[model samples]
Target chain A: MSVTTPTGFRAAGVTAGLKASGRPDVALVVNDGPSHAAAAVFTANRVEAAPVTWSRVAVADGRLDAVILNSGGANACTGPEGFADTHATAEHVAGALGVSSGDVLVCSTGLIGERLDMPVLLGGVDAAVAALSDTGGPDAATAIMTTDTVAKEVLVEGDGWCIGGMAKGAGMLAPSLATMLVVLTTDAALTAPELERALREACRLSFDRLDSDGCMSTNDTVALLSSGAASAQVDEAQFTDALTRACRDLAMQLLADAEGSHHDITIEVVGAATEDDALSVGRAVARNNLFKCAVFGGDPNWGRILAAVGTTDAAFDPRTLDVSINGVQVCRAMGVGDDRSGVDLSGRTVHVLVELHAGSEAATVWTNDLTHDYVHENSAYST
Target chain B: MSVTTPTGFRAAGVTAGLKASGRPDVALVVNDGPSHAAAAVFTANRVEAAPVTWSRVAVADGRLDAVILNSGGANACTGPEGFADTHATAEHVAGALGVSSGDVLVCSTGLIGERLDMPVLLGGVDAAVAALSDTGGPDAATAIMTTDTVAKEVLVEGDGWCIGGMAKGAGMLAPSLATMLVVLTTDAALTAPELERALREACRLSFDRLDSDGCMSTNDTVALLSSGAASAQVDEAQFTDALTRACRDLAMQLLADAEGSHHDITIEVVGAATEDDALSVGRAVARNNLFKCAVFGGDPNWGRILAAVGTTDAAFDPRTLDVSINGVQVCRAMGVGDDRSGVDLSGRTVHVLVELHAGSEAATVWTNDLTHDYVHENSAYST
Candidate 1:
């Protein structure tokens, strides 16, 4: 169980013949609820996909009955025709589910500059609706993948209600939103505005700090749907906490399964004057390709770390900065500390700590190292 | 002939036993001038090298008699000991050349966070001064290389005056101050302010646009020395043009030799609302790891280019932007224009033109594709 782990949700995935690989390419999640409330966040990239445009308007009224996602085509940069395709797909979903077209959301992921195979995708929507089951969550998760080697799904149980989510991405990941497609569901009774606030706060700390490749996708979208079937009136704080936990779990899974990643890096920036400064400092180091490559090679290159930190306008004195890797203080007071050869980097998880000596604020950013496989995976062709 | 092409300049490079390879590790360039007017730029990185700290103050009065550079140790992040080494080296150079220590500029480039070997480096400084010759520019050029495959030296002839320079940098190259150590010599009659204006303008257009790996270095410095020995009165425009040409020549050489990169990419942004916007757009694309990897794999992935452009705040309508790779308009009006398969990437020189369709402003950025060799070179132990 994934999204359906939260009650009053039915999901399905079916082959649409949209991908050349003949894999399942379409998925649907229906909110069969006494209350249908939803909120969504989209990629800030000015070049948004056609489905993102349709879904943005659909979620504006804060009521969504169903979300239809296709994995074969991004439906981005396809001009007016692409928008029409997304509109038609949403209308088809609404007609099949006996709801208004505006109540249905649409999402797409794949190549950026191509139109969707509308006929196959629409037919697959019919099959997906017919196959919607409470236990179809696993298939739905698998349907959204492009370059991902594994499906990402998470469930966080509250006192009585639960939050669950599924995400798919591998490359084109950076800040503001690491490139990915995500869908979250909860059984707790809540309004659309509450869900919006909770989802925004959750994503800001979870998905927004993952800089895998420093590439932002044009079709990135994350949506949250809630149904009051459980009748569990959860507290606002509890709801946000559970939602954030689910999103973080899914985000960590995505990082672990990032394409061609050899090491998962956690960059922790402490002693910042503000949260934004900490985030900026962490993200700068996270996105530094040279630093990432050094981590991949198991080279404890702290100079690259400080160089990355120097590029940011974060509050910190360069001469007073300190760095520790895996609990070994490699750089102290902006100078050499421990012997680099003593630090062990043969594990999959690499932790880098930077002390700015500015204030009490701190933030952590997750990233992956640059490797030959990363180049090979990204440079082969468009997904 | 390189820096020695200009009159009133003597340069020498000698082995200092500081490098394990016993290669020439010390270099000295002296301005034997009636007018010792000079100007220089240092890395904007807050964590600057000890030599950058010393040279910045030495050139503050806009006059310098000599510059001493070493290649085996950067003398950066070594705290007080590193600063002490730089101070001692400068004093030794000033004593040998019979000039005040304040008139001697010092530069060091190699592994950061390590102090230079004082005895060997100072001895090489003495040997460098004894061996100074009018035609030793090539030797001085060879002495400053770290990871560079070849020495980079260029001379540009003005109406009556000539501008010559030598540059050394193969990695950690980025905007504002492309990571490198450069020495420029001109025998034209000019004041310190004239030399400063010309050098700044030249670097802004040339070196400032080369973003190799999106990593800034702690030891980047570019110095311009005017001896006023040619007795030639050159026009300001001619002098700036010649200086720009020389810098551009050395900048290109750095790109060509940029740490195992196979393709030299020139990203030109046209029809922007402002030059800064154009540069921002081009640099965003140049620094995108996904796009660079695609270029390295010989894949014509135009989607990666647009995705990078979308990340910037540059002025452009994503729906109206156009991209041409190697003269093939692969993306037009933000949609697929030509068959990506038609774009040939077999050559070493790759040209990507992005049209913002906003206004008349244009800018160009030179970069290299992310390759396996870049990973291998950077992942290995520090050179």
Candidate 2:
């Protein structure tokens, strides 16, 4: 429930009228500790947002004291004006915190390629600075939101360290890391290089493979900030466990809030020749719009799974592939076998199990069913 | 206008009441005589429909005498029962035509993983045979359609050889080719080997690069049957041109009928390092649902285009990328360098011009916008 409960930092979320809905617009979380180690992963999209640009620069330093997140304006393709707004925000936040502007990270989520309302955003920045408190973690967790049904914040209490984070994504998600924006706070003591390495590993397994509809975004970012408040150095095992749990929990929340999503689907690829192959096959199925539509219809169309898998170069004999939908084996040896009447489509949750008959390692990722709401929400917006 | 206008064939179509919509569901096209040669391509999906399996084997011999197509049932996941249905239909058609069963090609389009309603299909097969006539081309075109607003049949008078074909793909279309069933008839006298070589070359540039939503299907087939009716032995150049034009026109029609399409989009990539680079970059943009949504909303959101193109492996300096939307230069040298005031998205058609500036090869592909109609149509049916 608390963003600070899992780690060594304080966060504050405040509403400053940036959004007409009167939701929180500004969130500031500071790592107040003996360690300033951090790592971050940014969107691979060429059209980067201003905040992503700022975060990329900050993450290069391998350390961060604070992250300033604002919703209601994506600060994306607004040309030079967008960059100026980001710089001005960092300056204002740094002035208030009495810290270097260069050390202050920034991220924004909302409409893409739009100019931020400097008057409103700057006002939110002032209010955020004024409202910052050691116990404002919950508010900060809810501040950076855009069309999300609820604030996505996760807290994990580890044996030797703590990890907490918040995420925002209701649309525009796919590999190459779509519009997902996250800020992870931890109390574990580590250097910038270490944070970068660990964050990439976490993202590779957790975020990078999370595909919704294969549309890459211009403002996808995931940042890690550590305060070293725990003081004790947590070993790599505990650190990864905490990071994994926090990311996993947050990732699911993102899936749950996907635009126009009904059924939260999970595809588990088992018995693959390699983890990459498993992921490749799984991602292929996840991105297939026709398959997702079938899931939305609750048709239990498992043939689409094999059809999607066949398009990949992953090593597997199609005829040797086996597929099960919600515990019912709909296909065997890469071809349709038994009557799918055994499978029940009444359930809201759809699960696809694929066996490659190659090796042991498996991978699973979550996504939501594609519905008219997704198309409506996305198409309704002019950009 | 005529399926047999291409080279050396005759065709027919008939209504057999297999479709609940009371539409035509049986079609047949046959080569006249002269030891006709042929080459064909089948869907890459592993979960092929029963007819796909049958026709792949039939066309594997590099010769085709007749092709039978139905629109009501896919005969996809009926297991052995489905194969039995395909075999029964093929055998019946071959018997009526006085030809070997292996020489008959087949295609089915409808819902996936469902039985072919064997009795109804067989009745339709018999009716199709009875309806066969030298000039029944339009009826044949009408018989092989499902959810299509109009039947897609083309007739082209070539220099030395004429080419005509009918294609059906209202949805489930992408590069690897999903559920796109096409049958071409030509009267040119050519060897099966030469036809094979020309068809592959034509397909790579025409059908292979077309992407709607990037989802491949399990029921795609494109078979070119030669009747050896023409006395002149045409060279490969003329054959390739006519073949490419026919396939390209069909591909365009498919894109125009894309499920839930509001706008027909053309992605033109020029100055790419290689044709592959051009295609990869073009596909990345063409498959982006957000861009499709934006196009539907009539917003010339160039940022989305840049974001999509940037995620590709095509070698290009993202900083040096140039984009022109509707001939209005928006981005230059990887940055916004010109006025975007000239962008007009008020029309139902859009053109996204991308310049990699890497080299001198250009490619154009047609796609449609992602709309609520598309989601509704695709998800509403179990197929």
Candidate 3:
């Protein structure tokens, strides 16, 4: 009941013989609604996947009857042939559901530069459509796994309506979205414009702040579909809040299950001149591989943090900056403060707070420690 | 006979007890010059090391009598105490040579945010001064090693004069100067201004282009000292060419021995609207950890390369871009082309060429493949 936990929605997951592991690889979510209101966000990368290109046009009219996603062989860099494959997949889904082809969005993930196995994929689509049920949300969430260790699902109930979402990503996760595939379902009576506004706001504060590996994917996509079948008229602020909470919850799941990560680290940057400054500073620190490795080693090396911070253009004089690891103020006034030996990083969760002493704005960036296993996993991945 | 390959220079390397391994950790190079003309470049990082701050001021007059460098402690983020330590070390060198303290430059590398051991450091300075000899260049190069597996040294003769240099860096190497310490000596008769222009031009094409790990160190410094002993007023172009060759040689050496790197990768971006655009594109691909890891796995993953190139503001149409690995044009016209299986990556060198199809400019960035050894070395370093 993940996606269909809300009224007037159904989802299904089925094996598509796309993943080498023989796991479920095809997922579908549908809306039987009096109103079809939708919004979507895609990867900012210019070299986008064929599915992303198709879905961008499909969801342009702010209505989507269904979304078909597959886990293997991202149709990216496959030229004209890739786009044709996406179109064909959407057409098949439309024919099965008796909906217009233009109202069906297709999403594909996995290895880039390869075309999908159309026969296997189309067969899985038929099975998914047949298996679609109100309790199929968890299965749909499991179908999109690449390197993800676990399925990610979230539900946030508003005053009278609810929003449910499922996300899948483990690596190639960065701001502006990760190598992720997400689908959201809601029963709130809102227009497409309202859903779009709420989605942008929700992602700006949630998915847009995670920079796990600083690698953007070509197949990143997030879509929202509202059925309005519950007849629950929700206010804009309340809907936005619920969406943000759902996205944030899924984002945390992505962080917690990042491949080969030994520790989940949160960098909270405060006293920034602006929110962008805070985000920029946090991202610089988040992408610093050396700092991530130090954290993986459980070494409270605040100097690495300062070195990373100094690389950013954020407002703050080097002499006035401060850094605290866990609860220990390891560095103050940009110099050695309390003894670092007192800081214990034996836990899996690490919190780093950086004070810029420039303004009142603040932001947090979530990331994972770079570990030897991460190097090993990634080094042997495609080979 | 590295730095001393050119006339009128003496150097020495001595153990300072600063390194736990008891290896040589102190180096000194003195310009026994009839003409004290010099040029230098330091790290662009705002949070510079104490030695970098001190050396900047010392080299401002364009005349340096000697340069002293140490390993085992970076002497950065130690605040006033660290700066004072750098000053004291310079004064000790100045006193030993009877030169002005203002003319003595200093450089240090190793762990950051730690104060140097003044007693052992000063003792090593005395020994270095006592042991200085024209043939001590090789030792001086060896003493500067941090994680470097081999000492980098090069000699190139121009006209009647000659230039010789040494460099040390195994990680944290990037543009705006690699995380390195380099000392160059020449016997050419040139003024400070001329040397400055030539040095900057040479470095801009060599050391300033390598982005090994995309981590900038706070203690990077490169210096060139002329003794005017050979009195060879060679053509400026000839001198610049020789200097650039020497610098490039050392840069390659640094790249070959990068920490835990199994492959020396070169990313060449061509057909950009401007040289800067080409450089921006190349640097983006070079710094992409996922692309680097893919290369380590011997995977011809051109999509990762394109994804990284898209992050840059370089002029290029996504649909017209092309990527080639080794001699195989795996991606043509932004789509799949030749069979990637034809590409052989069994060698230690990997070349990735990207054709932007935007204009007539091109640039190359050298990097290293990301591997588990790199993660292990860095993660266990500070701890």
Candidate 4:
């Protein structure tokens, strides 16, 4: 259940003195391969972090030798000076690994608008490189955590190759990615283009559908590194399926540990005029603070669901909408249907289904219920 | 200061037994004048309340002899039966006033997806009409509250003419209107068309720009009635200005009494490419949960503001953006400027300024901080 579960990968995690808690804060993952093919997706937010800007160009040629990540300061909104810091960090890692700086990708997560401590961060990077081992995946996963309470890792085995992945993000989870950093390593015989296509499709279905708090981040990165050591030349469809499953697993782990969340909600929107309409309706409901709060209180308040759907321009007749909570059809034909008291919400997982009665297309989005702890955690997050 | 502050208007409030707490839940306002001209705006949500649909048509011809409002049930999402209830309510009011049913407007607020008790509501309406008085403005304001903590009323005096207004909404305040129900009255002489134009402009600059929680409601209405009793024949521009001032004053009251809020935040976006751009930017910041939480914690986290501004498509160079919390310029040129410690946010009101440096346009939006109490109130609201 770690990145080193795959062949041709070495990883390490070390303390960086950047965090006030004195925990491990720097990680390094290197692909030792006869084939170094890579693909990545960064935050769509225009005001991106310095590391995102640097890594986007590093992975553009579909190749990378190593990835260096730190968790303490996000290095975002720091202007040119911040960008220069990221460049220097990459250069330092490249020198330690004997690889070109252009082949090294960097990722950072933590409070935004602050610069990283260069001397301390550089010392940690040197220590991480020295401690690199094939079984260091779990350590690396633990190092890249900011608010995450647990380390998220997954492994998917194919015919002759396997994929290993790790993710770190607890808050600011939203569409177009959250404040997350995900790294996937695989020992499969796939080219750069194939890996890119598979990674994009997998992320679109997994991470893109999770909106914990509707807060987009400035430093979201998901990178896939392929080392063709298995020499299995697997089918593209099969590879894509395995990659998607791994991503979904990590996404669920993130949802389970979202900041101050009480319930994990899966909103399924069906019978829409189009898939986009279904997604639009689902996202609108998922982002509604009132609906989330209702779920947190263990109340089957289907009225708030319909009101949220009404705000979207999705194709749906107001009078024909139907809503079900946890298998209880609380609302039908836009009015009260079954007894809301029959619905059971005294659990951590909840399912909300909305039928638009427009068409056959459908989509689903995942979210977390708003709770008092959410407000408390976020209120003093930067302080 | 309320709807009855103006000449030729009488209002009353009475218990309807609609609320479980036995609070006054019915209100009536009568325009007893030689000229009855009115205009109104309803929520933009597609699945609007039954009363909104009824009042939209009743005020289409720019004439309203009376306005009836009720709390404890929104009368929304109840299908045809809900529409029938609103129609019957208008007819009852019309019968009491000896006027056409189309000349009476109805408004309802409270929980959605529930039917109102017609017998109890109608009895309260009769009592309210019989108890109508010239000094009943404060009582009428109190009667129309759902979760509001206090009555909101304002009066703006002009040249022998005055505009009086009242509003009630504690949560679900958003753009395109909130869960608010507002009533305005004026004795200034003006035509229906003129009243419509002025009311729209006044609402656009006042209530429309206040977004306390970013949750649009299905039952929002702002109605203005002119009795033309003072015979002032006021200037159109002056009347519009006074009306806007009254709306803004009531809006501030709503902001001050928002549900479970700790701080009232005013976000001002300047140097935008267009007025719409400024508004979009301001609304994005106002709606960001992280930024709202930062304000609640009294942490001057300006990076969250920049991250929110980056999410919008507004034309602005990311490198040139500036953000100020309270009066401290915490961020300049997209990077750290003044020390965040220099900023002060221990007050109940906060001012955030963002300069785009893209053009010469500006806009402002009002919101409230995200606090634990907000989550608590909303989570258990309908439970």
Per-residue CA lDDT of candidate 3, range B1-383, in tens? 39999999999999989999999999999999987899999998888888888999999989999999999899988888889999999999999999999999999999987778999999999999999999999999999999999999999988789999999999989888899999999999888898889999999999999999888888889999999999657777888888999999999999999999999998898899999999998988888888888888888888899889888888889999899999899998878988988899889999999999999999999999988888888888877
How many times do residue backbones clash in model 2?
14
Off by over 4 Å in 4: none
Put down candidate 2 lDDT per residue, B1-383, tens digits, no spaces: 67756545677788778788888888888887775688888777766677888887898887788898888878775667788888988899889889999998888888766676777877877877777777778888888888788888887776666888888888888876735889887888778888888888878888787787788887888988888777767777888888889888888888888777888888999999899999989998998877888777777767778878978889787656888988888777655646665788777678889999889988887678888788787776663
Please give, for residues A54-158, the per-residue lDDT of candidate 1 as tens digits: 899999999999989989889888888899999999999999999999989898998877778888999999999999999988899999988888888999998
TM-score of each: 0.98, 0.94, 0.99, 0.99
What is the per-residue lDDT of model 4 for residues B1-383, given as tens digits with 9 covering 90 to 100? 78998999999999989999999999999999878999999999998989999999999999999999999999988888999999999999999889999999999999888899999999998999899999999899999998998888999999999999889999989988967999999998898999999999998999889999888999999999999999666999999999999989988999999989999999999999999999999998998998888888888888889889989999999999999988899888988788999999999989999999999999999999998889889889886
Task: Enumerate the candidates' DockQ scores in order.
Answer: 0.72, 0.53, 0.75, 0.81
How many residue pairs clash (N, CA or C atoms closer than 3 angstroms) in each of the candidate models, in the order given?
0, 14, 0, 0
Q: What is candidate 1's CAPRI-style docking category based on DockQ?
A: medium
Model 3: runs farther than 4 Å from truth?
none
Candidate that would win on DockQ: 4
Model 4, span A15-110: residue lDDT tens? 989999999999999999988999999888988999999999999999999999999999999989999999999999999999999999999999
Model 4 chain A weakest 10-residue run by lDDT: A330-339
Give interface RMSD, every candidate, in order.
Answer: 1.5, 2.5, 1.1, 0.9
Q: After superposing candidate 2, which stretches have Cα over 4 Å from the reference?
A: A6-8, A16-22, A78-85, A176-178, A191-194, A231-233, A335-348, B6-8, B77-81, B159-161, B332-342
Taking every candidate in turn, the Cα RMSD to the unseen true structure, in Å, is 1.2, 2.6, 1.0, 0.8
- How displaced is residue A211 in candidate 2, in Å? 1.6
Cα error, candidate 1, residue A87 (Å): 1.3
